[model samples]
Target: MNITVKLFATFRAGRFDIESRTYAEGTTVGDVVRELNLSEKELGIMLVNSRHVKLDHRLEEGDTLSLFPLLGGG
Candidate 1:
Protein backbone atom coordinates (compact mmCIF):
# COMPACT_ATOMS: atom_id res chain seq x y z
CA MET A 1 0.00 0.00 0.00
CA ASN A 2 1.04 3.60 -0.58
CA ILE A 3 0.64 6.30 2.05
CA THR A 4 1.56 9.95 2.35
CA VAL A 5 3.44 11.10 5.44
CA LYS A 6 3.73 14.71 6.56
CA LEU A 7 6.20 15.81 9.22
CA PHE A 8 5.73 19.02 11.13
CA ALA A 9 7.87 21.44 13.15
CA THR A 10 11.16 20.04 14.42
CA PHE A 11 10.35 16.72 12.89
CA ARG A 12 11.17 18.15 9.45
CA ALA A 13 14.75 18.97 10.29
CA GLY A 14 17.13 17.03 8.05
CA ARG A 15 14.12 15.15 6.73
CA PHE A 16 11.44 15.72 4.19
CA ASP A 17 8.37 17.71 5.16
CA ILE A 18 6.23 15.33 3.20
CA GLU A 19 6.81 12.01 1.51
CA SER A 20 5.06 9.12 -0.11
CA ARG A 21 5.99 5.72 1.25
CA THR A 22 5.15 2.17 0.35
CA TYR A 23 4.40 -0.43 2.98
CA ALA A 24 3.00 -3.91 3.35
CA GLU A 25 -0.72 -4.55 3.38
CA GLY A 26 -0.91 -4.69 7.16
CA THR A 27 1.54 -1.96 8.09
CA THR A 28 0.80 0.01 11.24
CA VAL A 29 1.59 3.64 12.14
CA GLY A 30 4.33 2.51 14.50
CA ASP A 31 5.89 0.52 11.69
CA VAL A 32 6.26 3.63 9.60
CA VAL A 33 7.71 5.56 12.54
CA ARG A 34 10.31 2.87 13.13
CA GLU A 35 11.15 2.84 9.44
CA LEU A 36 11.90 6.54 9.77
CA ASN A 37 14.02 5.90 12.87
CA LEU A 38 11.66 7.86 15.10
CA SER A 39 10.79 6.85 18.62
CA GLU A 40 7.20 6.85 19.88
CA LYS A 41 8.20 9.26 22.64
CA GLU A 42 9.21 11.77 19.99
CA LEU A 43 5.71 11.92 18.64
CA GLY A 44 3.09 14.35 19.90
CA ILE A 45 0.07 14.06 17.65
CA MET A 46 -0.81 11.59 14.89
CA LEU A 47 -3.42 11.86 12.21
CA VAL A 48 -4.43 9.40 9.55
CA ASN A 49 -6.47 10.90 6.74
CA SER A 50 -7.28 13.84 9.04
CA ARG A 51 -8.51 11.72 11.93
CA HIS A 52 -6.52 11.19 15.12
CA VAL A 53 -5.14 7.71 15.47
CA LYS A 54 -2.95 5.63 17.70
CA LEU A 55 0.46 4.26 16.80
CA ASP A 56 -1.04 0.80 16.40
CA HIS A 57 -3.51 2.05 13.80
CA ARG A 58 -3.32 0.19 10.53
CA LEU A 59 -2.66 2.18 7.39
CA GLU A 60 -4.63 1.90 4.17
CA GLU A 61 -3.77 2.63 0.58
CA GLY A 62 -3.66 6.34 -0.32
CA ASP A 63 -4.03 7.37 3.31
CA THR A 64 -2.38 10.55 4.47
CA LEU A 65 -0.59 10.38 7.80
CA SER A 66 0.53 13.53 9.53
CA LEU A 67 3.04 13.38 12.37
CA PHE A 68 3.89 16.12 14.82
CA PRO A 69 6.55 16.32 17.48
CA LEU A 70 5.98 17.45 21.03
CA LEU A 71 5.98 21.25 21.09
CA GLY A 72 7.26 23.21 24.05
CA GLY A 73 7.20 26.91 24.80
CA GLY A 74 6.11 29.28 27.51
Candidate 2:
Protein backbone atom coordinates (compact mmCIF):
# COMPACT_ATOMS: atom_id res chain seq x y z
CA MET A 1 0.00 0.00 0.00
CA ASN A 2 1.18 3.49 -0.83
CA ILE A 3 0.76 6.16 1.81
CA THR A 4 1.43 9.85 1.54
CA VAL A 5 3.09 11.33 4.59
CA LYS A 6 3.14 15.02 5.52
CA LEU A 7 5.27 16.33 8.34
CA PHE A 8 4.67 19.70 9.96
CA ALA A 9 6.47 21.96 12.45
CA THR A 10 9.55 20.54 14.09
CA PHE A 11 8.82 17.15 12.62
CA ARG A 12 10.12 18.36 9.29
CA ALA A 13 13.60 19.01 10.54
CA GLY A 14 16.08 16.86 8.61
CA ARG A 15 13.02 15.40 6.90
CA PHE A 16 10.67 16.26 4.11
CA ASP A 17 7.46 18.21 4.09
CA ILE A 18 5.70 15.54 2.05
CA GLU A 19 6.59 12.18 0.67
CA SER A 20 4.94 9.04 -0.60
CA ARG A 21 6.11 5.69 0.63
CA THR A 22 5.00 2.10 0.45
CA TYR A 23 3.96 0.08 3.42
CA ALA A 24 2.53 -3.34 4.04
CA GLU A 25 -1.16 -3.74 4.49
CA GLY A 26 -2.34 -3.40 8.08
CA THR A 27 0.39 -0.88 8.86
CA THR A 28 -0.67 1.56 11.54
CA VAL A 29 0.08 5.25 11.96
CA GLY A 30 2.37 4.35 14.84
CA ASP A 31 4.43 2.20 12.53
CA VAL A 32 5.26 5.13 10.35
CA VAL A 33 6.12 7.26 13.34
CA ARG A 34 8.54 4.65 14.60
CA GLU A 35 10.01 4.21 11.15
CA LEU A 36 10.80 7.88 11.05
CA ASN A 37 12.40 7.73 14.49
CA LEU A 38 9.78 10.11 15.84
CA SER A 39 9.00 10.30 19.52
CA GLU A 40 5.40 9.61 20.36
CA LYS A 41 5.58 11.85 23.42
CA GLU A 42 6.25 14.82 21.16
CA LEU A 43 3.47 14.07 18.76
CA GLY A 44 0.51 16.40 18.85
CA ILE A 45 -2.18 16.00 16.19
CA MET A 46 -2.52 13.12 13.78
CA LEU A 47 -4.76 12.84 10.76
CA VAL A 48 -5.46 10.31 8.08
CA ASN A 49 -7.19 11.43 4.95
CA SER A 50 -7.78 14.72 6.76
CA ARG A 51 -9.72 12.97 9.57
CA HIS A 52 -8.28 12.83 13.06
CA VAL A 53 -7.02 9.36 13.88
CA LYS A 54 -5.13 7.50 16.56
CA LEU A 55 -1.61 6.12 16.38
CA ASP A 56 -2.80 2.53 16.18
CA HIS A 57 -5.17 3.34 13.38
CA ARG A 58 -4.55 1.12 10.36
CA LEU A 59 -3.66 2.82 7.13
CA GLU A 60 -4.95 2.13 3.64
CA GLU A 61 -3.58 2.58 0.15
CA GLY A 62 -3.42 6.14 -1.12
CA ASP A 63 -4.15 7.47 2.35
CA THR A 64 -2.63 10.79 3.32
CA LEU A 65 -1.16 10.89 6.80
CA SER A 66 -0.31 14.16 8.50
CA LEU A 67 1.83 14.40 11.61
CA PHE A 68 2.29 17.43 13.77
CA PRO A 69 4.44 18.00 16.80
CA LEU A 70 3.18 19.48 20.01
CA LEU A 71 3.46 23.23 19.60
CA GLY A 72 5.51 25.10 22.14
CA GLY A 73 5.66 28.90 22.03
CA GLY A 74 5.10 31.56 24.62
Candidate 3:
Protein backbone atom coordinates (compact mmCIF):
# COMPACT_ATOMS: atom_id res chain seq x y z
CA MET A 1 0.00 0.00 0.00
CA ASN A 2 1.11 3.54 -0.63
CA ILE A 3 0.91 6.23 2.04
CA THR A 4 1.71 9.91 1.80
CA VAL A 5 3.65 11.06 4.84
CA LYS A 6 3.98 14.69 5.89
CA LEU A 7 6.44 15.82 8.48
CA PHE A 8 5.98 19.02 10.41
CA ALA A 9 7.84 21.15 12.99
CA THR A 10 11.09 19.71 14.25
CA PHE A 11 10.22 16.35 12.77
CA ARG A 12 11.40 17.61 9.38
CA ALA A 13 14.95 18.31 10.48
CA GLY A 14 16.58 15.25 8.96
CA ARG A 15 13.55 14.08 7.05
CA PHE A 16 11.42 15.15 4.16
CA ASP A 17 8.50 17.48 4.19
CA ILE A 18 6.35 14.99 2.34
CA GLU A 19 6.76 11.81 0.47
CA SER A 20 4.75 8.94 -0.90
CA ARG A 21 6.06 5.58 0.06
CA THR A 22 5.02 1.97 -0.09
CA TYR A 23 4.60 -0.28 2.89
CA ALA A 24 3.76 -3.88 3.55
CA GLU A 25 0.30 -4.94 4.50
CA GLY A 26 -0.79 -4.47 8.13
CA THR A 27 1.70 -1.70 8.77
CA THR A 28 0.78 0.78 11.50
CA VAL A 29 1.57 4.46 11.98
CA GLY A 30 4.08 3.60 14.67
CA ASP A 31 5.83 1.31 12.25
CA VAL A 32 6.37 4.13 9.84
CA VAL A 33 7.66 6.41 12.56
CA ARG A 34 10.12 3.82 13.76
CA GLU A 35 11.25 3.06 10.24
CA LEU A 36 12.16 6.69 9.91
CA ASN A 37 14.20 6.49 13.10
CA LEU A 38 11.86 8.78 14.98
CA SER A 39 11.18 8.70 18.67
CA GLU A 40 7.65 8.02 19.85
CA LYS A 41 8.19 10.37 22.79
CA GLU A 42 8.58 13.27 20.34
CA LEU A 43 5.36 12.70 18.49
CA GLY A 44 2.72 15.32 19.04
CA ILE A 45 -0.11 14.87 16.58
CA MET A 46 -0.99 12.28 13.99
CA LEU A 47 -3.57 12.52 11.27
CA VAL A 48 -4.79 10.18 8.63
CA ASN A 49 -6.71 11.78 5.84
CA SER A 50 -7.13 14.83 8.00
CA ARG A 51 -8.53 12.86 10.92
CA HIS A 52 -6.74 12.28 14.20
CA VAL A 53 -5.39 8.79 14.76
CA LYS A 54 -3.09 6.95 17.11
CA LEU A 55 0.28 5.36 16.45
CA ASP A 56 -1.40 2.01 16.20
CA HIS A 57 -3.70 3.25 13.51
CA ARG A 58 -3.64 1.16 10.39
CA LEU A 59 -2.81 2.88 7.18
CA GLU A 60 -4.58 2.25 3.90
CA GLU A 61 -3.67 2.75 0.28
CA GLY A 62 -3.93 6.35 -0.85
CA ASP A 63 -4.13 7.53 2.73
CA THR A 64 -2.25 10.67 3.72
CA LEU A 65 -0.51 10.58 7.09
CA SER A 66 0.74 13.70 8.79
CA LEU A 67 3.14 13.78 11.72
CA PHE A 68 3.94 16.67 14.02
CA PRO A 69 6.23 17.00 16.98
CA LEU A 70 5.04 18.24 20.35
CA LEU A 71 5.03 22.03 20.25
CA GLY A 72 7.37 23.83 22.58
CA GLY A 73 8.05 27.51 23.27
CA GLY A 74 9.26 29.83 25.93
Q: Give candidate 3 misplaced runs (Cα > 4 Å).
A: none
Candidate 3: TM-score?
0.94
Query: Predictions ranked by TM-score, top down?
Result: 2, 3, 1
Q: Residue 1 in candidate 1 has what lDDT?
A: 89
lDDT of 1 by residue, 1-74 (tens): 89999999888888899999889999999998888887678799999999999999999999999999987768
* Clash pairs detected, candidate 3: none
Error of 1 at 1 (Å): 0.8
Best by TM-score: 2
User: Per-residue alpha-carbon lDDT of model 3 for 1-74, expressed as tens digits?
Assistant: 99999999888998899999999988999999999998999889999999999999999989999999987768
Q: What TM-score does structure 2 among the candidates reach?
A: 0.95
Q: Quote the positional error of residue 12 for candidate 2 in Å.
A: 0.7
Which of candidates 1 and 3 is the stronger one according to lDDT? Answer: 3
Q: After superposition, how far is residue 62 of candidate 2 from its true place, in Å?
A: 0.6
Q: What is candidate 1's local distance difference test score?
A: 0.92
Each prediction's whole-model lDDT (CA): 0.92, 0.97, 0.94
Counting clashing residue pairs in each candidate, in order, gives 0, 0, 0
